[model samples]
Target: MDHPLLLAFGLLLVVEGLFPLLAPQAWKDTFSRLIGLRDGQLRTIGLIGVALGVALLVSFS
Candidate 1:
């Protein structure tokens, strides 16, 4: 796998995961629901995010 996208996704996961950790009660319930999603759902969402990011980069190029 080309690593830049994977690195970006890893960074995204850390930042996204931090939101709930930092805010605690405010975002806890919302994140908890997302945490329960089936594996496929999460993967789809992650792929969408990566695709969108790539689209943005390509557009600028």
Candidate 2:
């Protein structure tokens, strides 16, 4: 596709689906644990993930 954002989102979907598709039970367990985490803890995790993604993109580019 000509749109880089669209392609990136599509790839993201594929990667995100892999865990659930390959090991549904494990995914369910992990999700259950995630649900128990506090909002602050989840926000921290999300921030770290975003930071890592940005770092990777910066390094590659």
Please list the Cα RMSD from the true structure of every candidate, rounded to 1 decimal place: 5.3, 1.0
Model 1, which residues run further than 4 Å from truth? 1-24
Task: Compare the candidates by lDDT and give the number of the best one.
Answer: 2
- TM-scores of all models? 0.55, 0.89
Roughly what TM-score does model 2 have, to 2 decimal places?
Answer: 0.89
lDDT by residue for model 1 (14-41), tens = 9988977798787978778998999999
Q: After best superposition, candidate 1 residue 51: deviation in angstroms?
A: 0.4
True-structure Cα RMSD, model 1: 5.3
Tens-place lDDT digits, model 2, residues 1-61: 8998899899999999999999999999999999999999999999999999999889987
Clashing pairs in 2: none
